[model samples]
Target: MYYIVMNMNCEDCGRYIPHSVYKYIGFCEEQGKVVFNEPPTNCDTVSKTTMDSLSSVFGSLGWVYCIDCKAPIFEMEEAVKHIASHHLITTRFMYDSVAAEEVGAVS
Candidate 1:
């Protein structure tokens, strides 16, 4: 199963962003599905066109990190499990606050 660490805050760095950090396991399969942070609503069909347009812009954008301590997590699943067992994080979000600063460079 793929894991997505969403709405996580980094304790060490205190970088809190909403719906930015994402992690995916089992992404190599051709038939795999991309799970969003929130579930799709009934209005998805009506918003399909807008979503498609946004996809081209944001499809290649993603961030990954530890849910706790905000350390750079290289081995995702195992590291996350370890952190969860030992550390207590009060918040969760997608992007690390440090990473959020770099967004200006993308343009």
Candidate 2:
């Protein structure tokens, strides 16, 4: 259940930016590109993945946050399953309803 807390700005409830994806160079949503040495500010929005320097040594260095469950997941496969089963179905249903409305309007 341990995770590597990140030190950068990010979108809150940032969907599924697997912490493993960003190994180095934190992303600044404002800048819209990967940059280095940005003064680490309120990392509340970061993906909250895993580890700093020593994490590699200890090997607790891979994790991703789940917005709906509000927890850290250690494996990508498990994360995919979780999102697919828990979130995508609801999203698909909502999109289908909206699509129906759009079709009705068009007709």
Q: What is the per-residue lDDT of model 1 for residues 1-107, given as tens digits with 9 covering 90 to 100?
A: 22233343222222222233343211111223333323223212211112233233233432234434555444434444644464322123443447756677555
Cα deviation at 16, candidate 1, in Å, is 10
TM-score per model over all chains:
0.22, 0.26
lDDT of 2 at 83: 47
Best by TM-score: 2
The alpha-carbon lDDT assigned to residue 48 of candidate 2 equals: 39
lDDT of 2 by residue, 6-94 (tens): 43333221322222223223334544554443444634344333324223422454654544564566765665565444321011000
